[model samples]
Target chain A: MGNNPHDAGLTEGPAPMDEQLVAYLDGELDDESSRRLEQQLASDSTLRDQLSRLERTWDALDELERIEVDQEFTRTTIEMVALAAEREHQEEERRRPARRRRQWLLGLAAIVLACFAGFAGTWYFLPDPNRQLIEDLPVLQRLDEYQLIDTIEFLKLLRDRQLFPAKTEDASTVREASPVVAAGPSAVNREVGAGVAGKREYEKNRARIEAMAPGDKRQLSDNWRRFDKLSDEKQEELRNLHGALQLEGDREELERVMEAYCEWASDKLSAPELSHLDRLLPAERIEQVAAYKASPRRQFGRRDGFWDMARNPYGTRWFGRGVSGSSVKEYADALKTWAGRYVADRAEVLAELLPREEGTKWKAGLAKAPADDPEQVKSRWIYLVRWYLAGPKQDMPIDGEDVASLEALLSPNARKFFEQIPPEAKKREIPVGLRRMIGFHFQTGQPEFENLIAAEDLDRFRKTLSVDMEENLRKFPSAEKQNEWVRFAYFQSKLPRDARSSRDDRHSPGSARPPYGPPSHDGPSGPRRGPGGEPREPGDGPRGMRPGPAGIPPPPADQPAEKR
Target chain B: MLEVRDDNAATFEELMLRYQNRVITFLEHHTGNHELAKDLAQDVFMRVWRARKDYVPGAKFSTWLFTITSNVAKNAQRSRSRRHEVNLEGRDSGPLGVRPLEAMAQVSSGQIPARALDRAEVRDVVWMAVQSLNERQRAAVLLSKFEGMSYAEIAETMGMSVQAIKSLLSRARTNLREVLEPYFDFGSPPETSDDADSS
Candidate 1:
């Protein structure tokens, strides 16, 4: 009759006498039945084992029923609960914003609203909490980063339209096809206009010696100025004389000497002579001297040999035509140099990431807890973390055992550092405080982030970053820029409440936002390419008709300190 | 990466504060040490918070939440280091060495201790056996033995599926067997000895 078995049809072996034991122990069993079991158990080892198991089960139940927690643990976790509430409370209060329509009315607006409500019976509608956050009732822009960006943008726009002519996007295009490089005129050019021999004598003497050097066109513009300055009588006399013996009025002897000297000169200097023949020769039925410089052997127009030396730089640069082998190789070498910088650092972000995700969530709550519920809620906590001071002690190389052990102790947490990180990338969590500035989840190969950093001007821009954010920006710059773009990231991550924007700016010398060391350098260094590597001219985007400034030179990329 | 949205953390904390005192009382009773009990209570809160990100709303909140609480406390107690340590030093204080349970007795059975157990020896013996059980064994005993949790409900709170929890309770009983063997022979058989040993 007592061929009792393991829980009938159960996979595991052996049925526990646990239920009966509890009933028997609690005296819930009827006296006759309890007595029968007591009689059987007196000598039965198997039944006794079952009984023992049941009795211990009862013992544990009793013990667990009566245990309590430590006073400190309860108080501490409770305090954390209160903190989150307090912060949220303060934030909600601070986040209150005003209506623009109300602002438009100003002193009269409130009255107008009242009047409209009274007369038209305009029952104003308010949106749901989520919808209110969505609607542009008032931005969170009244304070912190948003406010600062708003002002800066306003000033920038004002300056772009008012102070500067607004450098056109095509201005760079004008660089290559350089207009005549008219500089401040030389004194000789002036003296020549005054028709003085003072400069001409100097040119004639220089030209005599220069004429001896083969193919040399040294100081052509200079000589031309001096020659123009020489008194017309000296010029006319020289023009009439023997060597100046107007070879059909090739009149300028200096011109002949300079051209003859070009053939023997080491290398050409000035460009070939220009076709301003009308000035050199009279509109005469005159003879030409092909070999005027060498009695019967040479030509006398300004030497046309130094063509390469006097090549047009603007044309070369604009057309990309004049690529001297030397400089072209320099650019190629530089490209190689840049490629070498692509190294993979060994440091990982897992340690920073996982704990924050797990710890903060754990710190915050129990399942089914309401946002404002103070009691009856199971407030989560980073208990082992708090006990062991887990956040700071975590190192990248910790063993999985330690990792799992630590994890087994705590719970999930809030988006601390990398709030912008997508769900999938946040494999491990970071601590709340460090997480704020650290959790951007861009993978190494993302093109959007890469292209932005690859722009020519990124190097220049990187040089300007603040130290706090620079190291972060280095491994991940474009995202950092995006972090900057949403003006609130710094304010969000850096714990704005604890370190309020310094009202006195820098009353605390050793503080995070200390007295100014240097100005923030990231105002865009000229224009840069977009995520697609397309050149993003500043002013052309959605913001306005103009872009960021051209001359505000971005800081260097190497300096980690200024990145933030 | 446990992604606890900031909003979720706030929600979780609210959950903790709501249930903390009761859960602490439960943990204290189970662990027999207020400090360990509190620590276990915190674990329950943290576990629920961590796990709740995926919590679907179909189940009763208390059921789901308590399920986690009970599971965490049991697991903590069953951990290798804690395996041998029993909750012998119950922290709940009251007249007659049972304040919390006395309150429970008032709520459940409604019978004063005097009416239920006139003999002090029986109560002492009952408590002595209870102190010998391990964590899950104790929880199984309490929930089933005292609080009257179904195998299924006990399974949910302890994070085990029903079958697994059942097996666990069975193992817990086996553990309880050893502690109860001598006690039972000493306590219950005496009443029946008049029929046998006396004969």
Candidate 2:
């Protein structure tokens, strides 16, 4: 009997005949199993009844299969299959070239890499021309210090002693020479003109300096290149004066002047100005004297001050450090207001200047200009303002007609500002705003020579450079170089046409001549001396060495400052 | 298949003609869209021709052909669902001669009679019931009844076990009986009385 629940009612049970009946209906079973199931179906009425039911249910599903496809179905399917076969063959053919091209590219890359590797290996062993320039960076940095030395012979003596490293092949031969006692013929001219006490000071300092280690001597040599160019006696006088300043007593007026010379050197006063400092207004002279006074505490005697001078003498660090916190907040607020006004103005200008579609493109490009950095945001706004004022040529060629046309576009105050500018400045197609900056710098007497403009104004001025000029400037794009260019532009305005024509000959790109003018601003005492050399009672030097009424004060009761 | 693999176009045409209606019928029952069924059937034959080079005949040509047909139908249904529209009301011309219900229902008076529908109406009722089964059950029932495939053959075609095919058909039968029993009169189906009596 099959163990079927439905058949259980007919014969207590049948041995799994229900599933076998389904298998028999589907023809899934082998002949033996099928025949057996059929025999069971014939003999057992109940099992036979179950098979009949399965047969009827299965047949009923044929009602779903009644769909007779259209007569065109077969033909269409064959056509499609044939078409697909042809397409696949063509597709394979199409892919063959791309596969070949990819393989070719890979092969080419491998060959190029091999060639590069071989070239790099060979280049590593060749001599590099700029090697000495890179190695001498420390010496070049200390060039201002070197300028303090007055006697070339004394420098040669030091070079012979191996205190200074040879900077070139010619210098190397001098390093091996024996020291001689006789002063060279230029000795008379070498008098630093620092009077007798200054002479004594040099002898005294020489004793202590002579005792210093070779490395310490080398460091001093590295810093004082100008000292070598000094006339012989001036070198001796400066050496003596450097020693006397270390003493805490009175010095002669001559020693004071020599002390002032060293101070000017340390301050890195530009070369042309350094040579003429003595004749400068007492205010400028006062700076040279204060530079001496500030030295003992600011640099020579203090480690931090020395490093500060070594790393950045001009205080250009201000560019990155920005102003104090309160000023930053003020600048930030001002920037926000300025940006808002420019954007509003830009909308009307863009609508007037461009067709609607192109206007939207312009708007999108301007939108991508960065706004996060206040300087960059100000630059972008300045660019847009100039674009509006200068019209299509953002950079108008410096000519009177163009300048007048640009001025016509400016506000009343801006036009009035340009009206006051010198006729010479009007001839250059300089941006109106930059002309204002230059005029303000000259009026202020060029305070902070390199950093003549405020940081915000400097950012805007840079955006005014011709695109080509701006690209050329990017090669040496340090904050210092940018300031140099700003300073150069101001000086360029001052140059006669002939001088302006030879502008590139005046200085290298990085160190253009400082604006040709007297120094101004800030000194230790009352108002800084006007360019008119006014005299004031001298203050004690950095240590307490004062220049008394008589030339040299008698040595103080305290054991005389150490003499060699 | 061997002749087709040898690049015999005539042999391939013969094979396609033999199965075209069967494939279309299976797809029609699966998708309930005669136009889509026709499209899918054409794609199935296209694939069979493309894959002819890789063909190795197994148990039955119908099994292999219907396996491809089953896959094509499922892929079409999946894509159709993603397209997010289903025309359950049948085609504008009615799917494969199974007239839309509005027309079919009009032939009968007011309420549908308890008695079996005529040939056209029966086909429509069966198609609707077939669509009601989930995809797997629908495939199982169609392959089993229309192709007369044994449980093993259906299992191989549908990628399921023989036991799974049995359960699938069992469940499908239960669902069809529920939806159709009202109209079918199970034992005879009216027109097949001789076959019922013989059993």
Candidate 3:
């Protein structure tokens, strides 16, 4: 989400801060921060003049507070009027199905057309699944050169025989899972767990994000402190020149502060550079430095703190906001392009009897997705992600997409997968296009059975299924995954366990955290239609309508309308 | 008889009700206009509503609410100035602290009237002073002078190092002093120091 952060803290360059003035005004020093400000006020006419103006503005603003309302108004006056309007509109939703159907058709068609404006109206997309997640291609090549098909065979055998050779370190050390301990009637059971080191990384980043802005506050105090420190005569001289150099976002304002400081320092230390030093530092950097310098001592350091060299996303290696690097931009643009596809890339094919212009109308047709509401937004995003993941719905907005745009859109989810992908499969992201081979990453057959499963995948999963599962379990061996794996092995174990073993230990140990949840690209294709709206014609001018973004399933697939 | 943190929603709602009118009044005073004040006040509640999900019981909620409100008011001021967001370096408060918005998509079709200054002065000179502050300094001043928060409380709410809080409050005061030098000098209270202060 961020870029290289060299001088990131200096977003506006260093501006000016009158430290003496700040110290004098706040009286935070041993004599109170304002002691310094009072001292400077005696000598600095210009700084004193600026203070006087601020005092007047505050007075005028204070009078602005006299406006009053009727007692204890729990709700706004406008809500009553809005509520009436809302009622009137809700009644209309009952009678608009026919009109909506037509509109939906037109909208879907239009959206599909808009998406394919680049592809000359060809609705088909053939995203080389390999090309989509090429963040680490060498890893893919390494998997190709070693351990592709035989691994899956071993996995199946392991599961089939229930041969669970859990490492001794893992067997006893696997943390036990506890059920939610209800605390109240309608109990909202909350678990405030600091997630493993990974989630902690995110939390740290988020906190740092929260703290960064207020740094600007100290800039003012620093300037005030500087101003308060000045000789009375010097303060008067600086203030007379119009003490306008006190804004937070602009650092050049510091030049004036620096000028005053310079003039005063020149008198005090006789260093000529003291005057122009503000010019060299710049307003933005000065603001950053002044802001950081003015703040109190930090207790947290790089070791156990928010941002250290190891994980600070805004480290010097990263490019700052401007045009600093090309490779990063290329990656960023690729990411954005992928993110865009997730929003609206898939198509919905309606009956040929349906019109073509309103394919994407379903999006806007969404029951009033008002921008101001977050609950509505959160609900919508969840719905969208689910609908895409679940499958192409007959009622969903598949009316106008050509396959290519759908491919472009669907690719982002794959990229998201890349973002959250486990390291074991990290090596198999890229496909080596040698001999037009298909390398699908499904099925765990024997080493010789690798040829039996002629994959269209680079076989990333097949290459490291056991190893990755073991690692993931090692990270967080939750009872859910373990139990799921146990249940699955019990069903698949087919072996008659010694015909007399203990009833509880019927199924011998198998791998914990079985790979049960992969998006099913299997089974017969769902109902399909082309531009001509032919009923059940799969892959004609374009491929079948796939789920738009990430085909994530909704929490309750049975009742899609009911939120989880 | 009861652990107060049990129903945070009730507590938070109580906190909101207790401070809602006070905050609106503060905004009106700060902006010198009631309508803008109301809008900012509404925005403040919207934040208090969302921040509920992140609420931790051990900490005081008022401090958190004040921080959120101060950030929202300042951000609203910036967006009103010119829609392009140069997001504040610190993220103590702001709606987008949740996630980045499609800020570039919405273009201003000139909602603010272009009124020429009566005398060769700047527009919304008060806003210029506020907008000039870094995010934290502005929030600190808003909480202290406008929201009437004590320094130690502000530190807890802001989650800053006290020295940092001191610098922030001091800088804010200095800026206010520089801007309102012509006004009254009724030195309200002594500087807040943690060594001798408690709830």
Best by lDDT: 2
- How far in Å is the alpha carbon of A438 misplaced in model 1? 74
Ranking by lDDT: 2, 1, 3
What is the descending TM-score order? Answer: 2, 1, 3
Q: Best by TM-score, which number?
A: 2
CAPRI docking class of candidate 2: incorrect
Model 3 chain A weakest lDDT span, ten residues long? A433-442
Worst 10 residues of 3 chain B by lDDT: B98-107
lDDT of 2 by residue, A120-144 (tens): 4433554542232222222222233
Q: Which stretches of candidate 2 lie over 4 Å from their true place?
A: A1-18, A29-50, A92-564, B57-59, B82-84, B91-117, B185-199
Residue A303, candidate 2: Cα error in Å is 99
- Interface RMSD for candidate 3 relative to the native interface: 24.4
Model 3 per-residue lDDT at A96: 65
Q: Model 2 reproduces what portion of true contacts?
A: 0.15
Interface alpha-carbon RMSD, every candidate? 40.3, 46.6, 24.4
Candidate 1 residue A539 C-alpha distance from true site, Å: 96
lDDT of 1 by residue, A1-564 (tens): 023342232112334454454445545567997997798778777666555444443443332222223335545664544454445444554555645434433433333333333322312243232221111111210111111122222223323333222333443342221111011012322243245443344344343434533311222222332333345554333322311111223212222332223222211111111111112342110111122322321211111111110110100111111111123333222222221111001112322433565444433422223424322121212121221222323322333443343333221111121233343322222222112111111111212223322244445544554563343333212343333222222222222232222221121111111112222111111122347955433222211112112211122222111100
Q: After superposition, how far is residue A366 of candidate 1 from its true place, in Å?
A: 73
